[model samples]
Target chain A: MIRLDGVGQVFDGREGQVTALEEIDLHVRPGEFVTLIGRSGCGKSTLLRLIAGLLPPTYGEVRVADEPVTRPRRDVSFMFQRPALLPWRSVLSNVMLPVEIEGDKGRAAYRDRAHELLELVGLKGFEGRLPHELSGGMQQRVSLCRSLIRDPQVMLMDEPFSALDALTRTELSGELQRIKMELSTTIVFVTHSIEEAVVLADRVVVLTPRPGRVREVVDIDIPRPRSLGRNAHLTEVAEISGLLHGLLAEKEARPVDEVRP
Target chain B: MTDTKRSWLTTSPVAAVLLPVVGLIGAIALWWLATVVFGIDSYLLPGPQDVVSTFLDQPAYLLKETGTSMIETVEGFLLAIVLGVPIAVLIVRSVILERLVYPLLLMVNAIPKIAIAPLLVVWMGFGQWPKVVMVLLVCFFPIVISTAQGMKSTPVELVELLRSLNASRIQEFFKLRLRYAMPQIFTGLKVAISLAVIGSVIAEFVGATQGLGYVIQQSGASADTSLAFAAITLLSIMSIVLFYGLVLLEHLLLPWAQETR
Candidate 1:
């Protein structure tokens, strides 16, 4: 339900224009879990922003639901690297934010849905507690509950688990796969962890850093209800991971002048 | 670790109340000794007991003056909160407003508020209006600066998150930005209340018929140093109470603010 065509982004650096992305074309089908993976500065987040319509691309188009994205759509929810909960609000109130911002029209209606989502994320009793009162992982789960409460068409996550510890990250990634299976919502996630991408994503879009360009797209054909153990099919994961690594290594050996200066 | 302590002085409601009182007693003891050792005349610096006697001797009159000062302080502070917050919103919402007003704000705050007190008396006349205005002047800047800083500091990711939901500007401001700014605004308020007390007192020093400021000034001229000391103590008490009042309000209103920090 989302597409980007020949997109480019240029940020005004102190010296001159610094290219963040260029000639990037990506298409995501509805209900698809797509992960964009690359080293830092590969414009994974820049691409996410384009899809969210947070910034106007220097050149090209991003569209969702076959509509040219000019501004943020109410049907798209964005999750940041940080949980980004309002510290002054209770966990329940923070989850209810989208409902509150959209107004009272059906807020009373969504309150129950919010509670259910919190329960889905294992944060039921935490509803009355503040965000900080929760652990970092719990806080991010609350953020996930918040993003889903709107029944959004697309959820864009920018390195949501990057700041988390390894155990928490792995645990959350496993849960995210289950959540996706249950919710059946489209997600375009950004992350650096190959294991996380392998576990959660149906397809991984790898990009070249510095004027980010789509280097390759690796499809994970592994069967679902996937996890770090049992059903993940680690052998298939390892082969695909090695292939992706070779693609990155090939470029790293070259040391392209464009990337450095 | 501190929570496990059972000592009466450190573990109960008594501990919470006793610590500051102990500090006060120590300070009083030091002052008493200083006066005895220096053999200073009471006219120059009255001992703590002398100040207490002044308050005890004319309790009704002193309290009446305190009431007047309290009215001025609260009014000025409330007005600062009401006006300063909105002005901060305006500054944050518009780059033009921020550009035009921010430097001017710095200039206004930089100018000694005491220097303006005499001017206020000249224009506003020898009445409570001058004192209120002076308090507003002193208190207003910190509120605006801190609130604007808070609003501006609303994480870019959160802004993008709200934007992804297509929240209206008003919705973004009221729901996200304002709440994000609460702890910071309270910090400004805590700082400003103390300044507001001083502002009103300074205004009173230039010209006023009532308030503890006027009482202290009157006592100074009459060489009633103990009375002046009492007035100063009342002023300090008012300042401490006002500062802690904001702390209490912050505790009640933004319980979540304390956690993340």
Candidate 2:
């Protein structure tokens, strides 16, 4: 339940004003997994920041749960591309960080949830280990556990698994699907990979770069637990991925000046 | 045989301690040999044993002076941390404060600390206060610079994550920024501790009636070169001990930091 109406972002640059996004409208349904995909400088991340309330849009409004968002809402959580674990904190403590910041009186309850979330992500015995002791994939898993620890109404993930190896990325995508089945949280993910977008998203929103604007929103009819390898929906996955790839390639071919206006 | 020896030197726990001990003994032996072979005057370079016997001659007196110097060093170090860290936090939190204070701090730091030692004595008298102030002055810059740099280096993703969760500024600082900055802060601490010992000695050199630095000065006047060597050795020992103490503390407190590096 997130909505952005006519959202735009413009940054003051050393050269002049730089438009990041223009006349954007996007809505994410509750329990839905939406992935935003485009090339670099597409303002994909800028768009996410606007929704997270880390930045205010130059024009238009963002609403979450039917309320205008003037600042970050407690019921919304964001995940980053990097693991971003506190190097001094143990895995459990890092996961418990959000709750600690909230100063919640019910810490014991959150602690239990933290442990459960860690186990859900196959990090059961890693509670005492430091973030650096783990592999990159494992560290990202810790980050995921942290984001999910609060049980937020919406989770905004900005390419959370893009840093991992291909095999790990695929594995994490499947695990993410499993986790999504168990939780009703809406998710808005940003990514560079078309296959990742296709496999993970209920709907993939493709944006055009250079003052990013929504080019198309493609809905996937594929069943859950989608895989990149041999699966029942392999053809469908390839078809959608190929379509998005072509769309993105076509955008790149168009002259930069033609798209500027 | 060489390969096995090399591996043992690296892999065996005993080698870890034994190797450094061997190196130190070799250094001492070289000094003793040079004094004997060259028939070097003890006035210029006393043998290690001569220095040791000099310490034995008045163990109580030397130890008392050592204690005084140690007190000055620890006190100044503690004060530096107490003042330096908060100033760094203030600098990081506000651009206006950074702009106003940064150049001033640089100018203060740049004016050779030795040049200010006499001024400190003039202002605070020839007591322990001057020495303590000296230590604080020398130790302050490294702590502030390292900590400010560390706080400013927090990953943007983590900051965004906290913002999306509606974290307060204080919470973002204490929970994310400060914790993340700790490894670098400890780096500053280690550097400052060594400087702390030297700072106190420099102040003592200017006008103190006590401390190892004063002992060295007195020995120089009396042509008791062996005693001066003893005091110099003790100062080195103190600096080494304090530096390693911080290293040990960092190991215990931030085991994760070591792994990340």
Candidate 3:
């Protein structure tokens, strides 16, 4: 459902031009859960931004649903590391924000969907509460509901559960999998954690740091409802996680000319 | 103290009200004691009772003057919000306007407001216009600066989320930036309101026949030290009331702001 062809991003920094990403080619199938993982300064988030159309790629092109993405499209939604909720709005109001922004005529229908999304995320009684009243996990769940409110064709999530405590993070990852089973939306999630990438992604895209390029795309063949603890697929999860860790830790001394893949 | 008792003292609604009152009474008692012990001349520092009696003697006149000052302060504060918020929006929306107007705003804000009080009176005459203008001058900077800073400080993720949803510039602003900046904008408003009161008084000090500032000025000329003290007390009361009024408003309007930060 999404394609990036030779996409690159160059930022003008204080000292000189900083290439954030380079010579990137990626494709995400419809209903696929693709997670991008890399160390800091890897431009994983930059790639996501290019696809979201928040920032145009400095070179090449991005297409979603076979259309060139010159700007943000109506069928895609993005979520962030932080909950980023509007502090003055109640949870329900915040979930309805996208609909309100679109000035959609069927607000009542959207409102009902908002409640259902909130309920799906186990936030049934929090419609009247503000973002501050929620725990970190709960707030992120609210954000999830918000992004899902429009029932977009694609959702781009950047480290959505990384800010939570370890237990809450695991819990949320499980819940995300459950939610994904019920919704057909394609997802491109970015994360720093190797375990998280293995747990959530159908394919994990490893990216190199500094002028980021796609290093490897590892397809996860593990079954659904997979767990990190005492599960049938624990060995597979550990194997994939270790491989990603090694890839991230390698400090290759390749020449600049040889760096491009 | 018992744990529950200590918690009650810290958290009880009654304690919140009583503690400040006790502090005020203690402050008044210290002042009364100092006057009696040092045998200080009433001309220099009137006793609390002397000030109270003076206020009692002509409550009607003093209240009328207070009403006039209140009118000027409210008008100027409202005007500042009306003008300053839009200017802030304009500055945030366009880089060219921001660069052009930012330095000019800073230059205007840097010139001592009191230095311009006389000029305001020269331009607008001895009527309420000068006082209102003075209040606006002092109040404008805080509102504009805080609002601009707030708009600029919106989390990058939130902006991207809006953009990814295909929200228009106007929707991104009203539905996201404006609402997100509210807590900081209220911070500016609180600062401006206090300055608003002081600004009106400063204008009254330069040339006015009414207001608490004028009353204090008149009392100074007549050597009515007790009356001056009464007027000063009223001024402090006015400042306190206005500040708390805003606090209450913010609490009611943006209940999420207090806990989110």
Which digits, one per residue and each the tens of the lDDT, describe model 3 over residues B1-261?
555456666889999999999999999999999999999999999999999999999999999998999999999999999999999999988999999999999999999889998888889889999999889989999999999999998887777777777778888888888878888999999999999999999999998989988998899999999999999888888988999999999998878777878
- The per-model DockQ list reads 0.69, 0.72, 0.70
lDDT of 1 by residue, A1-261 (tens): 998887889999999999999887788999999989888888889899899888889999898999999988888889999998877778999899888887787887799999988888788788998777888999999999888888888999999999988888878888888888887889999988787787788888888887788887888888887775555488888888888777766655333222110
Q: Worst ten-residue run, lDDT, model 3 chain B?
A: B1-10
In the predicted model 2, the residue pairs found to clash are none
Point to the candidate with the largest DockQ.
2
Error of 2 at A90 (Å): 1.8
Ranking by DockQ: 2, 3, 1
User: What is the TM-score ranking, best to worst?
Assistant: 2, 3, 1
lDDT of candidate 2 over B71-113, digit per residue (tens): 9999999999999999999999899999999999999999988
Once model 2 is optimally superposed onto the true structure by TM-score, how far is the C-alpha of residue A76 displaced, in angstroms?
1.6
The candidate maximizing TM-score is 2
DockQ of 1: 0.69
Chain B TM-score for all candidates, comma-separated = 0.91, 0.95, 0.94
Q: Give per-residue CA lDDT, model 2, range A194-243, as digits (tens).
A: 99899889999888887888878899889988875557888888899999
Off by over 4 Å in 1: A230-232, A252-261, B1-16, B29-49
Error of 1 at A223 (Å): 1.6
